[model samples]
Target: MKSLRLIFCALWTAAFVSGCGAYSFTGKSTLSSDVKTFTIRDITLSAPSSYATISQEMTEKLKEYYQRNTKLKLVPQNGDISIEGSIVDYRTDGVAASSGGDKAAMNRLTIVIEVVFTNKFNEEDNFEKDFSFYLDYPQNQTLQEAEKTLVPKILDQLVLNIFGDTVAKW
Candidate 1:
């Protein structure tokens, strides 16, 4: 009876460990390619000199997201597909304001991007589309800090828009 109990406990522990590895492949919902490799070319930023960091930030985010969510490797060249793009527009509008002042109490920043995705093997898979995102600036914050914060928010939205179209079904 003692030997039987020990064997049963060992079997139970093994089964538990195996079950943990049997997850439901959730990452597949976000990426379509089974190709396991891709490249995102350097995005062009068509803004003032201050906006240069936004380009690098978006590129890094794209690479990081793919690395974290899929089994694919980011290849520098000769990839199965490539995503290239430019920042077409950037604007700031007041969303809320003090009644007596020209300055805004709160502001919203919108960034518009035009992206071209190309599949080297299949022209039919290539796509060119525009996406836009906005971030709100706090009234108490300096314009400089607002500028810094806005880029990440836009990049986050850009990633969501790209991933949804490419992999997630609508």
Candidate 2:
């Protein structure tokens, strides 16, 4: 019985180590061994709205997310993985109206981000996708009040989706 337990433990450890070697625990990336660096070009603001900071904030946040979660070096160009795109939409609409139907009870703010990810080492994984997310707030609140709080929250999910599609293999 003791020997059987010992063998089981050994097998489990071996499988976990081997399985994890090809992927990052956080990003869940199955990055090629030859891949060493990554690049993120400036994201453009294509959305026709007053949320001018979306592009800048998204670019910086994506850079930081990859830098924090991956082992790859951040290069200006010619990297193993390259990413770029735009903020394609910034929309707000009433989600729910008051019982009287005279005023909105809740409003939603949505952001759309489109990205093209190229994996030079594995061209099969290259893709262009649009990631979108939203936040709901009281209709009485001004966009200025809701914008500051909602932008980052929605952007976080958008970044996560992009990261997952590009590198996480999820």
Candidate 3:
């Protein structure tokens, strides 16, 4: 009986340790063992054609984000999961009025992205939707001056929303 109790305790400890490894602190992933790879196609810019590099930057940012957050392999094509999106809108609007005039004191830079996510393993989880975010800047700051700092912040929010929808399903 003493040896049996020792064996049972050892088995329980092994099972608990292995189970803890299956949990993720970030986004939840319902991916099966066979669904191991993903593909993110080139993101297009339908918003402002003048900023030619925006699309490429967004694409690279998202790819790098997924690589950092998930264990899925990045594939060129025919992956178990696929994400394709476009920057549909990029514009600035006045949000806060000036202290003593009709002029604006603060402006908001908004970016609208349209994403389509496909899960080959579970067709029920597929979706196509718009993910948009914004940043506020003082009226003194020109859009050009703000673009460098604001674009990344906006993209980060969009990435988080998409990640939640795909993995966490929230």
Candidate 4:
């Protein structure tokens, strides 16, 4: 019985080691090595409005994500990696037109962001990209409040999308 226990332990250790070597979390490890610390500069707003505050909120959330999910640290100034960008566009349009060609019972908010990710070490070309997101607002709800609620959720998804595309290589 002791010999059998020993063999089982050996097999388990081997399997664990092999698993670590072979495993890859596609969207989780893209910047694993090139970036040790990251700095997200203030995001520029396309048009001035209450939404301007959303930019700073997004920066903080992204920094938190990196801190929690990766080994990367968040630096105040120059760091191995940096992200800077602007809010390029913001618009609200009607969704689902009515039979009379009028705006229907819902509206859509579209936010577009232009971003650049730089590798200070010159490990690769700077990444410049644009991404957008849309959310439907019920006709009865206040646009202002809806906008406020959507900002964080939109920022969260945008962060995931940006990181996955540029760093995660997804």
Candidate 5:
């Protein structure tokens, strides 16, 4: 009876696993099977107020995100999937009012990136869109001081959004 129960459990587990056909824990199923590689062109710094390193940082961060999350290999040029874009906007503005209502209590730094994603295997999935994110910091902190911590967080979210749009389709 124990042996029979073990066999039954094995059969049930197999059935459950098979039921998940095309569903992957990493969300790779959304990408066509032909998509085995990807490429990210240089992301230009088009925003006049944006610092120079931001463009390069964003490009590298995106590459790293895809490498970590997907099985696709990184290529130099055209691949199964391609991504290119530029920093369209970068600015800081007061988001919250101070107790006196005369000054800002918090400031928000926002970054907007224009992205063009192309899928060779699935032309319908190609898209050109803008993804943006922001971080709020105390008004007392200078942009430079807050940027050291805030920029990374903003970039992380932007990358995630881009990933969702281009690959995860979520």
Candidate 6:
């Protein structure tokens, strides 16, 4: 009976594993097999309000994200896939009003990126789009104080969104 039970458990485990053959924990990428390399041209800052280093920071983060998440190699120019873009908008605005309605209770920092994706293997997948993200902070804090913590978070999400649109096709 013990031997029969062990065999049954083995069969169950195998069945479960086989059923997940198509499942990918990292999420599915629609990139074709022919796409083995990618390039990200230097990101430019068009927003006068944005800091000087923001463009460089964003470009490096994007490259690192793609390298870590995908098997594609990085090339300097004209790879199977290429991305080029500029930061079009970066500004702060009042989001929530105080009880007196004369002042803001919360402030939001927003960033907008204009992206152009080129797919050498699949021209139909090429696209140009704008991706935006924001972070909210209490009105008591200055923009300088909030920016240090919020900018990184916003950039990370922007990169993820760009990745989803270009490769994952989500």
Maximum-TM-score candidate? 5
Clashing pairs in 4: none
| Worst-scoring 10-residue span by lDDT in model 3 | 22-31
How many clashing pairs in candidate 1?
0
Cα lDDT tens digits for candidate 3, 63-154: 88888877889999988989999999999999999987788899999999899999899898789999999999999998988888888888
Separately for all candidates shown, the number of backbone clashes (residues 3 or more apart, or on different chains) is 0, 0, 0, 0, 0, 0
Taken over the whole model, the C-alpha lDDT of each candidate is 0.75, 0.89, 0.86, 0.77, 0.93, 0.93
Whole-model alpha-carbon lDDT for candidate 4: 0.77
Summarize candidate 2's per-residue lDDT along 1-170 as a digit string, tens digits.
Answer: 99999999999999999987755566555778688899999999988884758888988999999999888899999889999999888999899989999999999999888899999989999989888899999988998899988999998998888988887877
Model 6 TM-score on a 0 to 1 scale: 0.87
Candidate 4 residue runs with Cα over 4 Å from true position: 1-23, 32-34, 48-52
lDDT of 6 by residue, 1-170 (tens): 99999999999999999998766555655788899999999999999887668899999999999999899999999889999999999999999999999999999999999999999999998999999999999999999899889999999999999999898766
As a TM-score, model 1 comes out at 0.72
- How displaced is residue 65 in candidate 3, in Å? 1.1
Better of 2 and 6 by TM-score: 6
Candidate numbers, best TM-score first, in rank order: 5, 6, 2, 3, 4, 1
Query: For candidate 5, which ten residues in a row score worst on lDDT?
Result: 24-33
User: Model 5: per-residue lDDT, tens digit, 51-106?
Assistant: 65899899999999999999999999988999999999999999999999999999
The better-scoring model by TM-score among 1 and 5 is 5
List candidate 2 stretches off by more than 4 Å.
1-27
TM-score of each: 0.72, 0.87, 0.82, 0.79, 0.90, 0.87
Question: Every model's Cα RMSD, please?
Answer: 5.4, 2.5, 4.4, 3.6, 2.0, 2.1
Better candidate number, 3 or 6, judged by lDDT? 6
